[model samples]
Target: MSTDSFDPVLLEILGNKFASVTEEMCLTLQRTGRTLYVKETADFACALAGRDGRFFAYPRSIGVSGFVGLECLPAIEAAVAACGALEPGDVILTNDPYRSTGLATHLPDLHMIEPYFDGGEIVAYGWCFVHCSDVGGRVASSISPVNTEIFQEGLRIPPVKLMRRGEMSPEVKLFLDANSRTPEANMGDIRAMLASLATGRRRVAQMLSQHGAAELGAAQGALMDYAAGKAEAVLRTVPEGSYRFADYLDDDAASRLPVRLAVTVTIGGGKVHLDFTGSDPQVATAMNIPSCGRPHAWLTLRMLALVQTLDRSAPLNAGLLRPLSIYTPPGSLVNPEEPAATGVRHAAAIRVNDILNGAFGLALPSVLPAAASGTVIPIVMSEPLASGGRMVQVIEPLIGGTGARQGHDGVDGRDSGISNLANNPVETVEAELGVEVLRYGLRPDSGGAGQWRGGCGMELSFRILSPGSHVLGRGMERLLFRPWGQAGGQPGLPGSLVVNEGQPRERRLGKIDVLEVEAGDIVTFRTPGAGGWGNPLDREAEAVLVDVEAGFVTPDHAKAAYGVALIDGRIDAETTARLRAAQTGSEGTVFGPERDAWDSIFAPEAMDRLNAALLALPLSRRQARRREIFETVLADLPSAFPKSPANAAQAEAAQRRLETCLAETS
Candidate 1:
């Protein structure tokens, strides 16, 4: 495509070589890293970037897969402008979302960049990131959904030299050590990142020595061009049209008001545009996504997923995003301004994924699947030890099932659509924390009933063995809207959190910040199930009988949902025939009763007009005015919103108030 194009065979060889180097770099980091997140959850990544800061080679099977589109140039340029240019053994470090132009999404995600020098000039760059255990702030993990500002989240390290001439910069080291609660763990992770960078440097040097610097440079550009061409070819398959879809998060964690995320995808001529203009304003809490109003990695993850789905062999690099464009409103939740806390940005990103998935489905229905469980809550246990030090360990990284598609049933008890984090073993979690696992399995009948059943959600129930233990369930969602089904399919069950089931003092909570429990206290977390596809009546009677026997679906549920009559462990053909004939046809995409009730009041078209009007006002007035309108409507209903449905009278009053506000707005 360019003057530097090499032979097709050689280009393929070099592309594999560069990708292998980055994968090896990641393995080295994981082998050397000391934290549970690195060793088990794999919350880390490594990449080889071009001089322009776009990643040309990224590891495919390791670490966070969504970061391939993240730009390293802004952080590199900031470090260079602040402190001179390219030299051997000079590395840059930063975790400030604003300072790095959204390179480091949050303070907990520490990013490092190293310049790969050959002769007297820089050839390529080495980049990596790790989610450290803690950076001292208002919370133990430096993350809480209620945090209102970045300063409250954790230490913000601007792009500065962490290493100079192979020596650790004492001044930067001191600040880092002083600002972290787990200083030793943070330092160990940082050293592991440095080790990963060194591995990249060595591998890059060998390539330069074998192929010469000129060919290596040409290969970098050529590989990215190849990936871009592949991505464009995939986009061309979508029917040329504009599709709009909207989804909602239960709330902004700190408030009872439901948060909305809407997207309009326009596809034509081998290109796609994602417009997120009607998303809710940046919240006062930490759920804001720091995209810097640009096509950040978080905003373009689904487009990358689309390309990969079309052609698995398509190169996993920044070039995959070449055919995609994005428009995230400046102060919207997707692209918040500086000073906003982003510790829980993943919460917003999940809803963004759903909206984009829905919009694309309108254009290429067969190419995409239904919605996944769309929630990830790493259930963390923090217990006070006898020695007075606190012990923090994840009990389990709980997830729900995948959405059912045209011909395939959704996956049960596991969803890797967003982040593919591994769950902690029962023995490992028990040994680390003062807890005992009671039950960990898929929830029965949690999957939405359809011709092809949607994936089932998971259940994690445990008992705390020690007093003074606080459990944190961050990034929990889908409790309100419920993952929706499509094409006459039914929605799955909503998620719930329960304490001391069957006891006299039973409690059910929603979106907890932290819940302290005494010894012998039991806690159960049940994630929401994914949406199903096709109609339940169309499902085979034998499949329904099998699900009933396996306890995945109860006998009564099978009869009601699938109209399959089962008697004495056998399908009753006569009764089944009568039941199927009387069953009603499904209408609309099922979002469950909760979403239907809520949307009845805050309708999509009205909310779109309201959000646009709110964004038009000054930034300082947006949140206040928006909150006032929601509070007015919620004032007439029960404290628990969609969870506790409003009576006919309450619903009518709330709808009237909301309509008045929308009418007065624009």
Candidate 2:
């Protein structure tokens, strides 16, 4: 049966039914889940895949949001090739990124697929994944950004049957139990996933009974085709041209050298192709994205967000990716080799979203917003238990705000560009871990200044209640460079990490590996604000007063950044007018002072030429060569370098040295 055989009304109804089944599965998983990551953070997802192994239906409300486009075919095929054909009661489990061809991007994300059989023939598949608390690796949570290779990140679980013939496989269970520090919690979450799959199985069986196998199949195809058409329509709205943008990870977790991610997005004939040709080579740290040279979810989530933002009625499925194509260089940061670590891939993925947003904004300035906060740090704390083991739980999945658009201000203290994870409540966090929540709110003046102001960043401060505790902050970023602004707007402030703020022995830190803390130590994390949309001087004085009164923008900041002066509680009209008249408006994109300083020395064209030359060398030698050139150039400048701008002569000398080094290397 073809999609043409199904009426539009029937297709819509079937689409709703399929989506409801996935939501039900997600609700079931969340209700039965044991780990804090699942129950509170909602770091899990459920989906229904057709026989083609592409998701036809995925949960919208509950669980992680950006994984709708993940493919299950590779894992399914691997299982079949290894352990024979799948039976009705069999469930395949895997967390090997390469072995499953990017199905499980990292080790902690345990992915499972179960076939839904209809009358002895496979009709659909049930898929779900949970971020296990521990999978036995170098650290307490099995995810350290400094892990140099996949082997140090965690245990690799290739596609194998976790359950067979309606019975749990003892061999698989034994291996899983032995590897993790939190075996009981992992087992509980696994059981919850099994229950979720069962829910999907039953729901699909009901749909099959209602519409029969052939009609159900036809409806599935029809729904996806409808979504694909909608996606193409959205793509066609973008002008046919190549828009290039690049962003950077503050540094590889193990070093001070920045990691760059560049993309050239070409849109034509209702299709978009992303060429990641100028991105840096994969680093020795765990921040590498494991795309397997495919348009993986990490690399294409911005496309998904763009379609949904324009057409909310489009169904969430693989069809939304039908118009998208991607080309990631073999050993680049976006598509790393097999042994490259991926424990903290989300750090790099967040920057990918920024570059994609930047490129698309150039194509359609009014439709897309400026850069978002571009960071999501899952702050996990591990406290020692009396049983000679550590109790690991995520204190919070902290994130900043969205970017401002043409006619609106950005949302404050919340960003869903990547994972839309809900923050764990203070009470729940305190109950599970040894920490006391102190101050949790928005940071005033953190957002960029513009006609439409960017969203404010977040602040989280908590006091440790247990000594000898270890704090692990994965996905920490946006420290060195601020989120860029569009049009004539100003860039947002950079992020900061402080321990025991305002007290003796206070210390400021960059990204952390595994920080040890005492009982009375207080930890504070202030995330970066999003970028603004228009010229700050063009903003209304009344709007600045409103922000000042609401504490979103401080009085001094309003005077300095927005050229709006306030006296007592009211705006001083004369002073504000005088201040506004003295400032000149900026044009185009504003990448803040630090990036401006860095770029003055290492220009984009120069870096592009250097990267092209570096890519020609062997992968083993690329990183060292790139580092040597950068270090030699940075040697003559101040230790702070970009954060502290060099004199004209110093900068010119550094540029000459960079040129000479590039020529010699070439």
Candidate 3:
């Protein structure tokens, strides 16, 4: 290891300093960034990459929904090719996910790469990215599930020199200014990213002064190797075997059909191979992954993480990926082809997590936790008030319970498969908009029944105190298939939202737009519950009693979900014993964890193949491409197919019209 070639102690200190420098850089960006997703939501990331483009050190947790996959090498190389040479003061910007690989998924995700210089030579580069508010497109928010092509999604900027020498480029500036719906917000985010780059430059210089440039370079490579070693050790712990998992995309938004992803994970002798051979082809929609057949690290970080979690000693680094191999056939969802709208890749990724869980469960059933609530629907509802025109607002970001582990019941009302973002406070929601939050708490009967009952879901209801308003609900999934349970557990409830004028016959709206309504319209949203662990009757009476007092479970649900009867606030010990001993009926059969189901489907190779097939379809036939693929898969699942064929056929026809309209402009 180059780390050993140098002074180990010095390299360790330099490594610590490198991490500190990048962290401080992120802190600075958050303080200065303009958008709410930045300043409020904290969706951003900053890191110091070695001159080689690989991150020597990256944040463990911070910023943006999913950016651990982003890299600066390609963008930097592109800039050098364009400008002939990159000076000390130059910085590059690119949001083209296809060009940057895992770097930037969509246009709003602005990435900046700056070269760090030392003694007239380049040492490293600092990088940062944020999902800006807009980049000029068909919608107010630059991202939309309806976008069939990248062009409709937003302006695509390949890796380009945004700065030259010491000044911002005039052409870059003019182009950016013209292409954004929210130009001011985009510029604010860019400035924040640029500031982070400057921070990387400064801290890198400090590390060089202490450890010397050569040692710093050596440490970067060594650290990566060390991480790989740790990951391998972790892989060795899992019982060597091949595991299969599968998951689904609720829909491509343009079609009612659900997309399927299947993966088979082969892990043995410290190696992991992800195969996506039978997975469906790519879609015409933007909800695709742009991996280009290459096994991008971001695509498989969770698998690595699951291994690391099982083996706590495993180090985080690119080396961890060495033992991991992926097979993503072109024209699939996990690896999309040219111009397949990929505005929302995370939607597909969420399912990928499930597939890995299933495969891991097959290999190490006792070690891993059960499936989570299985979906994250941050439902944003907007409306207009009496004195002012209506605007959009997030009523609440709905989240489900966490999956139950072997020894513990799943956590209620908290899970972060995507971004472990904190839910907005109900008080904050009420204060910012004309709404009164009525119910914001756990869903009592929603968790799947099991030995250890599944965690309860949540229900949030509010009244629009003002008049006309609009609602935009993104990231909504698992509304049909309830969150599954594990062992002998039950499934959680699906979520729903309805608007009414104080009557039972209210209205349920799908992906909404501007709406007119009076002051008394009430909206309620319910999130799913987590799966359970073990058998319901086997659960200890004390645990059942505790739940009764917690209000998360009631006496009726206790008996129904767990077969534990309550007597005077205490479990009827004698009756419980009798009931427990008599446990029977189809009600007792556990649904198992959803992680078991989703994990079964979205294995690494499965995603690779799925994405590759999606990418193989030429840009022109993307909509029809996505529909046929998802429709075929959904046809098999009677209980699971979200898109009714009749409607999907209609939407597929409509998507072509929309794609044609977009093509004429593109």
List clash counts for every candidate, in order.
0, 0, 67
Where does model 2 exceed 4 Å of error? Answer: 68-82
Best-to-worst lDDT order: 2, 1, 3
* lDDT for position 559 in model 1: 91
- Can you write out model 2's per-residue Cα lDDT over 2-121, one digit (the tens) per residue? 896678888888899998999999999999999889999999999888777788888777899566335523444554456568888999899988888888888999998899999999
Measured by lDDT, the strongest candidate is: 2
lDDT for 270 (candidate 1): 91
Q: What TM-score do all the candidates reach, one by one?
A: 0.96, 0.98, 0.84
Query: Which residue segments of model 1 deviate by more than 4 Å?
Result: 1-4, 68-83, 549-551, 644-652
Q: Rank the candidates by TM-score, best first.
A: 2, 1, 3
RMSD (Cα, Å) for all candidates, in order, is 2.0, 1.3, 6.6
Off by over 4 Å in 3: 1-8, 64-84, 380-397, 427-436, 465-468, 501-505, 509-520, 585-666
